[model samples]
Target: MGKYDLLAKDIIKKVGGKDNILSLVHCVTRLRFQLKDESLADDEALKQTEGIITVMRSSGQYQVVIGNHVPQVFADVCRIANISSEKEGGQKKMSFREKSLDLISGIMMPAIGILCACGMLKGLNSILSYLGLYSNEDGIYILLNAIGDSIFYFFPVVIGYNTAKKIEMNPFLGLIIGAALCYPTINGVDVPLFGHVINATYTSTLLPVILIVAIAKPLEKFFNRVIPDMVKTFITPMLVLLISVPLGYVVIGPLANMLSNGISQAVLSVYKISPIAAGFLVGGFWQVMIVFGVHIVLVVLCITNIISGTPDPILAFTTFVTFTTTGMVLAMWLKTKDKSLKQIALPAWISGFFGVTEPAIYGILLPRMKHFVISCLCGAVAGAATAALGLKYHTMAGMGLFEIPALLDPAQPGVSLVRAVIAAGISLVIGFVVSFITFKDEEPSQTKGEEIVSEKCKKEVIASPLSGKVKPLSQINDSAFSNETLGKGIAVTPSEGKVTAPFNGTVMMLFPTKHAIGFMSDQGCEVIIHIGMDTVRLDGKYFEAHVKEGDKVKKGDLLITFDIDAIEKEGYSLDTPVIVTNTNDYMDIIAMMESGSTVHCGDDLITIL
Candidate 1:
C-alpha cells in the first residue's frame, strides 16, 4: 500500500463512504467529489482528518483540500475506493448554476498548468527582446513564440477534447471534430451549405466546438442504438462526423461564434463605460466571487474576448487579486508570532505570488479578518489603476506574477510591458504596505510561563460565551456541529450579538469572515466558538472581532461583537455553536443547561471531567 492509503481510506469513509460518491476527480490540489448527497459527507471529520487541509462545498462539488500532495493522494483514493479516476456516468441532477460551474471547472482545471508555463515562456521571450538579448526575428524568439502560441492556436481541439470527456463522449471524436473545423481546406472556404456561406476558421475559437461536442454525444448514442453490433463501431463514428461536422460549420459554429462575439462586445462596452469602475469592481469582488464559485463566469468571458482577437481587460483587471492576497499572507507571516502559522503563511505567499491564491486565501487570509479586507481594498486600488492605464493581455495567462508576460502586447511591445510592470509594482507595494500596517499582531494578556502553567491544570466547568437560550449540539442545523465531529458542543440562539471569552484562554484562530473563533483554555480545553450558520458568506459585513489569534483573555472579556438584526436580515442563522474541539481528551462533557433555557455569558454551560 502507498503512504496515503490509510489517509485515503479515512477520507473515503468520512465522505459518507464510496456509495455516496457519484463521480470523483482531482485538480492540482483538490479532490472534487460529486456526491450522492452533499449533506451526508462528514465535513468536520474530513477537516479534522490527518491528511486533509480543509473542506469546501462549492462549484457543485465537495472539494477536499489536500494542498500540493493531492495528485498522489488522489491516486490512492481511486485505488482504495475502486472508483474510476476518469469522468463517469451517474451525475446527479444539478441546478443550472451548478452545472455551469462543473462544466467550466472540468474544462479549465486541466489546462491551467500548461497555460501558466506558456504564459511565462511568452513573457520571458518579450523580456529578452526588450533587453536586446534577442530580436523578434531570432531563431530562439520564433521557436519560443511558436511554443507559447501553439496552445492558443489550437485551443478548440484542447477544449473540445476536455469538454467531450466531461460530457462522457468519445474524446477522440471531439478532437477530430475540432480538427475538421480548423482544417486548411475547410477553413476560409465559402461552401454554399443550405444557402449559407460557411467560411470560418475554428483555430483559437471557444464556443463552437464545445457546443458541437455537447450535441454530438446524444447523436453518437442514437447512431449506436440503431446500428448493428457488427458494423456499429465504424458506422456510428462515420455518421456522427458526417452530420456533426457539416452542421457545426453551417449552423452551430456560426451561432456560437456570434454569441461569443456578442459577449465579448458586451464586456468591452461595459469596460468602456468606466474603466476604473470596472477594474475596481472586478478586482475588489474577484476573490469574494471565487469563494462562491461565481468567478468561473469570467473564465468564459476572458476566453471569448481572447478568441475575438481583443485584449482581455477583465482578466487584466483582476490580476491584482492574487498579488494582494500574496501581500496579505506575507504581512501575516511577518506579524504573526506563531511559528506554525508563519510556516503556513510563507508557502501560501509564494503560491500566491506565482498566481495560485487558494492557499493564501484559505490558509492565511481567510483566517485573518483585517488582513483579508486590506488585501481586497488594495487589490481594488491596483485594479483601477491597471484599467485606467488601458492594460490588457492578448491571451489568457496564468494569474499573479506569472501573468506579467501575457500583458506584453505583440504589436506595441515595449509600451504594454512597461505598463504591466508599473501596474504589478503598484499592486504589490500597496497590498504589502497596507496589510503590514493594518494587520496587528496578537498580544496575549498572560505571560508565556503563566500560559504554560495554565495548560497543565484541568478546568472543571465551561461557561457560556453568549447570553442566549441553550440547545443541544444535535439540534443545530449544521451537520459538522450537530454530528459532534469536532467535539461535544452546545448551541445558542443569541438574543444579543456580543461574544465574550467563556474562560481565560489564548485565541488560537480567528476566521477572516469574523464569524468563527478558536480558543485554547488556560486549563487545556480547546474550544471553537462559531458565530452563526453559513455566516462566512457575509464576509465580515456585520461582524467585528476585538481579539486576534494568540491574544489571552479573561472570562467575560469581549471577544467579538455582531449585529443580530443585521445578520438576520442578511439571512444568517444566529445559532452559535460553542464546541470543545479536544473532546477526546476529556472523560465526559455534560451540558449544564437544558434546551430553551436562557443563560448569561460566563454562566456554567458545560462541565468537563
Candidate 2:
C-alpha cells in the first residue's frame, strides 16, 4: 500500500476493518464513518495511526477529523476497501435527527465557523454599546460591523460555491451569482414584476443566493443535454454561465428575494404578536428542518433579518434544541452499560459544551425515543423562556463551549446574556432531570408474543434490524436520499437496540466510525445497513458482529448486533435502515403488507417484480 493506503489500512483496522463499517462520507478534511456499532473503533489506536490529525465525536458522527488533506485519504480508504456509493437494495428509512446531521456536516461545517465569529462579534458590539464605550456612529464600530457582517451579506455566494462544489457544479458560476447579489447595480435595480417593482437588497439575503444555485443546477443539466460531448465540460459551463447569470438577476434572484422577504415578514409578525410563541415554534421545529435540509431555507430568513439589523429570533430559539440535546447527552453518559459508550459520552458532552449538538444528538442522545422527549421538553421550555424574556443574540456564534465574550451582552435589554444563560440553564436542567428520572437502563426488547406480523409477510419478510416504529420511504425528507435511488428499502422503528443483518453476504467494507455496514450479496447486489442518522462516530464499540469477512450464510444470519442499552447510554439513535443497491436492475419491488407490524427472522419483505 502507498502512504494513503497504509494510512487508510491502519485506520480501518483500528476501526474494526472491513466488516464493521456500514457507510462513509467525507468533508474537506475529514472522513465521516457510520459504523455498525461504536465498540469497533479504537480511538487511541486511531490517534496513534499515521496520517491522522485528530478525532472528534460530534453531531452523532465519529469524525476522524483530519485536516485539509482528508479527501485523498477517504478516497484511498474507499478504493482499497471496495466501498460502493450505491447500496444493493432500496434505501433504509432514517429518523429526522439522523438525516439532519448529514445535511449539515458538509457545507455547513465551514459556515458554522463564520456564524460563530459573527455571533461573537455581534455579542461584543452589544456589550460595548451597552457599556457606552462607543457609539454606533463611530468609524471603528461601523468597520467592525462590516467585517463581521460580510459572510452573512454574501451568503448566497458562499452557499453557492459550496453547493456547486458538493453537486459538482462550477464554482465560478456560483461566484458570479454571489457577486451579482453583492453588485450595487443589481442591488438598486427595480424590476416591475406582477404589480410592483422588486425592492430587494441582495446583501445579507439568503434566498437569492440559494435560489440562484438551485436554478443553476437544472440549467446546468439542460446545458449538458444540449451541448455535444466533444466540448461538453467547458462548453456546458460556459453556456450555463451566459444563461444563468442574467436569469439569476431577472428571474430566480428576484423571485427568491420576494419569497424570503415574505417569510421574514411572517416571522416578524409572529414574533411581534408573541415572542414566546415564535420561540416555541422555532425551538421545536428547527431540528426537524435540519432533518431534511429545509433548515437551509430558513437561513434566508435569518440572513434577511440580520441584514435588516435585527438578528433572527428563530436562530436564537434554535439553540434550545441543542441545549436540550446536550442535557440528554449528559443523562446518557450517566446511564449506559457499554464501556465504549462511557468513552464517547465525554466527547459528546464536550461538543455540547461548545454547542455542537450533532455529536450528542446523533452520537449520544436522540436514539432513545423516550429520552428524546426529555430534550424536547427542555427545548420547549428554553424556547418559551427565551421568547418570554425577548432575549436575542446579536451574533451568530454557537452556544455551550463556543460561548465567548464576543457573543454575549446583558445590557441590550430585549435579549441579554442573563436571559440567554438562564434559558439555556433551565433547559439543561429540565432535560437532564427528565432523562435521568425517566430513561430506562434496560436493553430494549419485545416479548415473543408481541412479535406479531401481517399474514402476508409470514414467508417473505425481513425482520427489522432494530425494533421500533417503521415508516415509509416517501415520508423521509432528504432529497438527496430517496427510495428510487436508495433501491428497495425498509426503516426500523427503534428507540434503541442491536442491529443485525437480514441476509447473507460478503461484508464489502466497514467504516472506521462504526456507524454503518456494507455487504455484497451472492447475486452481486450491494447492500448497506446504516444505524441511526449519523452515529458513525461511535466507532463500533457498542456493536457486536457475529460474522467477519468472507462469511457465507442464509437469511437471518447474524451479521452484526448492537447494544441498544449502550447506544442509548451514549445518547444516539438506533433507527436502522436496510437498503438494497441494485434495485434499478430489477423489474419491480414489492413490499409486504405489514404496516405497523413487528417482524422476526426469515420473514418475507418484498418480491422483485
Candidate 3:
C-alpha cells in the first residue's frame, strides 16, 4: 500500500478496524465518521497517529481532524476500509439543537487546526520570553506573535464562511458580512437597536456573525424568490449585501453583544460572591465553555481587564483544569492495556500539560464521559485550593503550563508561586488516582461476522414467545420495528394466541393496552414481546394479560394470551416482534432459527452474546 493508503489502514484499525464504521464523509479539515458504536473507536489513538489532526465528537459524528489533504485522506479511508465515499442512508435529520451544534462545530472545527498551531506558537513565544531567550521588542517576537494571532483577529470572517455553507447561503456574501464585522472602521462601533444603545464590537466574536449569517439565509432565499430571472443572481447578492451588512451591525451585532455582556456580568457576579467557588467553577467548566465556543467574549473581557491593570483571577483557575486533564490522560496511559490507547494517552497528557488540551479533551476524556467528570471534579478541587492560597494572574499570558509563571505575584513574597505549584500537584494527584482506579480499556472490538465473545461474556438465549414462522425484522410491516429503531430482534407470526416467557425474567411492564409485554431477563436483557403490530389500538380488546408487571416468570410460563383471529380480523397483523431493547449492551445478537423456519414454544429464537 502507498503512504496515504497505509495511513488509512491504520486509521481504520484505530477506529475499531472498519467493522465499527457505519459511514464516512469529509469536510474542509475533518474525516467525519458515523460509527456503529462510538465507544469502540479509539479517538485518542487516531489523534496521535500520523496523518490525523486532533479528534472531535460533535453533531453525532466522530470527527477526525485531517488538514488540507482531507479529501485525499478521505479517498484513502474509503478505499482502505472498502466503504463508499458517500455516507450510506443519508445522515439522520438533526434537531434544531443538533443543527446548532453542527453549525458551531462545522465553523469552529475548520479553524481548529490553525488555532492549535497558533496557540502552540504563542505558548512557545511565552516560554522564550520567560526564559529570557526573546524579548517582546525583538523582531522575531513581533513576527511570530502576528502569525500566531492571524486566525483569532480574522475569526469573524472565517466563521461567516462556515455559517454560509451550513445554511446554504452565498459564500462570499457570508465572507463580506464577517469582513464587515471585523473591519477596523466597523469594529467596536456603537449603535442603537430596539430603543437600546449597544456596543457593536464584532471583532473575533462568534455570536454576531453566526446570527447575521442565520438571518441572511432567509433574506437570500427571499431575494432569490422575488428577483426577476434575468439579473436574479447579481441582483439577489447585491440586495443581500446591501441589507445584511447594515442589518447585522444594527440588529444582530448589538443583540449578540448585549447577550454576551449579560453572561459576562453573571460570571463576574459569581466571582464577586466567592472567589473560591468561582475558581472551582472556572477550573471545572472552563474547557466545557471552550468546547461550545462561548469563551471568546470572556477571554476578551479578561484580556481587557489585564490591559487596564485590573487583576483577573478567575481565568487563572482554568490553567489548573488543563493540569487535571493532563493528569487523567497520564492515568489512562499508565493503566490502559491497549497499546494504541497507551500511545495516544501519553502524548495527550503532555499536550494537556502545555495547555493544549484538545488532544486529551477530544481524543480521550470526552469519549469516556465518566472519566471527564472525574477530571472536572479534580480540577474543581485544585481550583478551590488555588483560590484559597490566593494565586492569581496580574498579567495576561499564554494558556496551560505557561500560565504558571504568570500566576506569581511580586507582592505575595513567592508564596503564591509555591501555592500555584501546590494546586497543580493537588489536581494532578487527584486526577491520576481517581482515573487510574476507575479507568478501564474499551470493550475489545469483536471479530468479523459472528462475534467471538469472551468466556466471561455470558450468552442470553431467548426462547420463542409464540411459535410460528420466523421473519427478518426488516421484512416486518411496521417501520418502527422493521427499521430497528426500537431495537434489534426477529419477528414471529404467531400460530397460537398465547405468549410465554422467552427467558427466566420478570414482567417489567404489562402495558395497560395488553398489546405488548416488557420483560427484564435475569441475564440482564430487556426484551419486549409485542403480540401484534399496532394491536395496542385494540385497547385490551381480544387481549388478556395473564401476568401483571413485576411478576416473576419461568421459561415457557404464559405472560399474555391474545385472540389472534380477532386481532387479524381487526386489521392488525399479528407479527409479534421479540425485540432486545438494550441491543447495544451485547456484542452481537443473532437468530438461532432461520427465517421462514417453523417453530413452537420453547424453540430457540435469538442468541445474544
Which prediction has the highest TM-score against the true structure? 1
TM-score winner between candidates 1 and 3: 1
Q: Give the whole-model CA lDDT for all candidates, comma-separated.
A: 0.81, 0.62, 0.73
C-alpha lDDT of candidate 2 relative to the true structure: 0.62
Candidate 2 local lDDT, residue 225:
88
Lowest lDDT 10-residue stretch of candidate 3: 448-457
TM-score of candidate 1 against the unseen true structure: 0.72
Which candidate number has the best lDDT?
A: 1
> Which portions of model 2 miss their true places by more than 4 Å?
1-110, 128-140, 189-200, 214-242, 267-274, 281-304, 307-310, 325-345, 358-369, 393-395, 401-415, 432-609
Candidate 2 lDDT by residue in tens digits, 441-474: 6554565334432221233334355555666555
lDDT of 1 at 248: 87
Model 1 misplaced regions, further than 4 Å: 1-10, 26-29, 49-53, 68-76, 79-84, 87-89, 338-340, 443-609
Tens digits of per-residue lDDT for model 3, 1-609: 555887888777766556557667665446777664443355546666876757766666777766556778888888877776543433433467655555555555455545546655655566566567877889998998788666667777888987786566787888988898888865665556578665656775667788888888898999899989999889998888788888888877778867756655676687889989888887777768756534444555564343334566777777688787888889889888999888778778876776767667767887788887787788888788878877766554455666675665534525666787888888888888888889888886567323433331578899998989999889987555676655689999989889889989788877677887888887678888777765655667998888998899999998888887878888988888888877767888999988899989998999988
Best-to-worst order by TM-score is: 1, 3, 2
Model 3 quality (TM-score): 0.59
